[model samples]
Target: MAPRRLDLARFAGPTAEFARYLRTETVGGFVLLAATAAALLWANSPWHGAYEAVRDLRVGPHALHLDLTLAQWATDGLLAVFFFVVGLELKRELVIGELSRPRQALLPVAAALGGMIVPAGVALLVGRGAPGMEQAWAIPVATDIAFALGVLALAGTALPTTARVFLLGLAVVDDLGAILLIAVVFSTGIALLALGAVVVLAGLYWMLQRRRVTSPWLYVPIALATWVAMHEAGVHATIAGVLLGLLTRVRADPGESEAPAVRLEHRLQPWSAGLCVPLFALFAAGVPVNGEALRAVVTEPLGQAVAAGLILGKVVGIFGAVLLVVWLTPASRPRGLSWPDVLAVAMLGGVGFTVSLLMAELSLDGADVLTAKAAVLLASAVAALLAAALLVLRSRSHRRAGSRHTDG
Candidate 1:
């Protein structure tokens, strides 16, 4: 029994170490955002017609009938990959990240909860009972960790490691809240038969897991079918990504074999983060905003709400909640992260990308809501810029402070 346990530990050690290395060296999220920015610029450029034409272009077999505009393919199809990655991250954090411990999770969880609550409240206040605007409340609740953390990663080594971990945890909790809100608030009318199909598919997935079907290919068709059924069933299709990711395996028990989900997540990480996310960003993060549209953004209620919620509410809410947690719970602050570092992270929280875009689709009028979307894009850009700037400043400040202390 002891020999078996020792052997199992030896096998699992390398896998866990690899997972940590991936987390530490993550560049996919930032690369995706950068690609997304370029796409947005191109879509709104003089070649806007070409951009639209490419998205609307279609090619597929009659039997498959897979015809989608470039945008739809990116949003509806590729984003499943993005959501899948999100699920893996969420699982990892729950298993080993900041949320691994109940006590360690409390601060970020509280901060995320407050961040979600206050932004929606602010959006409601500003929406002023406008028709269809209530649905927009959840728009502000998400924190784009990739964009946010990418901004912080720019600060290099000036920031404390704990601060980044804290932000990462906070963002994960924020995403979980966003997922729940989507399930409850944003879900459209349901199709019972399609939902039943989804349930059956879920059962099949579990059975496969029980039977130890470890090959990822076995689940691919099932996952694809689940996404299609979800789309047909009127659930936001991205939830399929989350569900499928959860269904994947992690490491096995100490003395048992490695879990298939963990193996799958590890295998899929490169593709999901490296390929799917970047492709999705490149296609989805574009809006053809002209000079006229820019002017209209100020008056557009949807635009105003998204802009305010992401830009102002994110930083204000995160910072305030962090402070409140520290005040209420002694020892809440992580060692080596001064208030300034916390402030820098709060600023990075303003970069709302994935959830922001998703919410824009759900809440905004689209086509007609072009102005509002332009507003969202513009606001997101501004927030990213501001957040990056603040992180840079904080980095310098921390370095200078360290130098002075050393001299003293």
Candidate 2:
């Protein structure tokens, strides 16, 4: 019993540390933004050719079909680590956090559905008859977790904790929706043997977790194999990370100090946030914003459609969905959030990054690719600025109300 008590005390330390890490992710957000700015500047400068050269430089084993460009490595390889952390966090939320309740979970799930559907509709309507309109509609359907959460941390620190949790849950669901869309829309066809291997490996990992097997040496190889299998299966390798995270046992076993999910999240989150995500941004966000690119974005239906979907569509979709859910269903609105807070966060959902770029690459070609990327960048920037203003206003209002209460 005494030993168990000591283990419990130790477990609490990492749990607390994980929460602190989540709060300080603002720093990682800033780092990511800095990398993005640098990429843009370097991409536009005289050294632009060198930047492209480095980005396009390819290396890796050819036999396994692993050879890919530096940019592809950043997106396909490094971002997997980031998504693994996201998976862990999301599973935790489902198990113990705001999303644990069925009623509470419904809100974000509905909002995510709305966020995706409305944007697709908006893009389709606006980009009607345009080249690539068929697939490019998905470009504005994602909300970047890192960028949205970071901006919230910067602008809404004084707001209630529930608002943050709501946004986190919403963003996680939103990204998952985007990933599923990629799977269905872009997949050439799955490699059945490799996918089957991933299923078997993931099952073994789960069995081992349940049996409380704790050897990194054994797990590391299996995890790597799962990732490889997923890649070979013609699905995004990052899905492997999410699958493993969900399979990991989040509950601590008897006499165990910490849950496996919590422990792994604490250790891997720093690497994901500090290194993997920022590197992904550096490589992925280097779209040209020159006069020609800007002109294409503004003058073309594709660009106008994406911008509208992000700025106007996200707001209407998210906010309207929340209201509809509250009025029409038994799902309880998340506490500590008001209509204003919801609206502000809804606006923040418009700042789609990361996945939007991938959609553009997958869906468009030639100068149209550049045009789509430029639209994404410009639209996301506008969304971020608008969300920031609303968030700041809400934070100040919350603070002033708190002050009056204290004085009374």
Candidate 3:
């Protein structure tokens, strides 16, 4: 009898833990969204130059341009820390989070893949062989996990817990695809010496892991060195965080216990949720648009293509692909979410603020940068608004139906 009871309790564990995690994510989501909006207004107001000046001023050692503009440091530097958190999340998920079980993993993984492939295909078509247009290919592929999850959180008791979990899992996989896209597509020039140094550092990091050096301080210096080396190696420096994080040994086996990795993730969750992400949003989210910028968004090929890819491509590609998968594979639908709920969540997937902004900065140069940024702002804003509206509507309907059932 004791053994049977233990089995039942073990079955109940994930459901309860996930419920608590969903609540935490929902609250954190609200705070992140508010901070991001405040930053946008501050960056664009009459004090815009102050925003630009603060971000652009350099502050490192005399010999090192180590002091990048506030924006560059946020996007290229601090955001690497964000990616480190991402690496942790990815590792955790693969080992135990949604991906731990094949049945649970299929829907989100398939949905994420469809989300990525369709957007790239659409962007490439829109680019239409123009000069520099090819660089825009990866822009549509990112799903801003924070903003997407946050918007769902604010939908106010309408989104079911099941839908929320599915969205979070889907976003993680989508982000993984975006990371791969960056490492493979955006990197054009490679410095062999810098790459070699990065490899050597990675080896050292692995050795440290083997020796069980789990202290955060020991890894900090190594992380910074890896970032510098990767920056010099002509790969985006942020990839350093991803690689380093991949090497970090989690103390606990999530599969067996809430391992060391899970513990670290929980500890860092608030910092990432509160500070790193919000600050990064403030520095990276601003797109100061003028009359000229409006004209460019409408006229520039790259800007126009990006806007279409994100706004149109994301909604159609993600929802449509999920539907096709459901039809083709009877086994593929996500549990705990109805088709209507899934479609509503698909609209939410359209909120591509963080990753879209990062891609705009990296993919365009010269005068095009301004235009691309404007496009990203416009596209993301529209997507978020539309997605939120649909989700609110769906929730109302779901609530009414539940009430009717209760009354019956």
Residue 407 displacement in candidate 2 (angstroms): 3.4
lDDT tens digits, residues 58-100, model 3?
A: 7665554466776777777877877877887777677767877
Clashing pairs in 1: 55-70, 248-261, 249-260, 249-261, 249-262, 250-262, 252-259
TM-score winner between candidates 1 and 2: 2
Q: Would you list the C-alpha lDDT of every candidate in the order shown?
A: 0.71, 0.82, 0.73
Indicate the residue-level lDDT of 262 in model 1: 54
In model 1, what is the error at residue 316, expressed in angstroms?
1.6
lDDT of 2 by residue, 1-408 (tens): 000001223335776555445336476667778888988998888899999999999999999898999988887788777767767776777788657888778999899889999998999999999999999999999887677877888999898988877787787678678768877787766999999999999999999998899999988999989988999998888778878887888788789867998788767766776677778778877878878889888889999899989998998999999999999998767787789999999998888877788788778888788888888889989999999999999999999999999999
What is the TM-score of each predicted model, taking all chains together? 0.86, 0.91, 0.86
| Candidate 3: regions farther than 4 A off | 1-23, 26-35, 62-67, 129-131, 250-258
Which ranges in model 1 have alpha carbons more than 4 Å from their true place?
1-26, 58-67, 255-262
| Candidate 3 structure lDDT | 0.73
**Candidate 2: how many backbone clashes?**
0
lDDT of 3 at 130: 55
Candidate 1: lDDT of 219?
A: 81
lDDT of 1 by residue, 28-114 (tens): 455666787788888978887887788777755435445656666777777777677778678767886679888889888887887
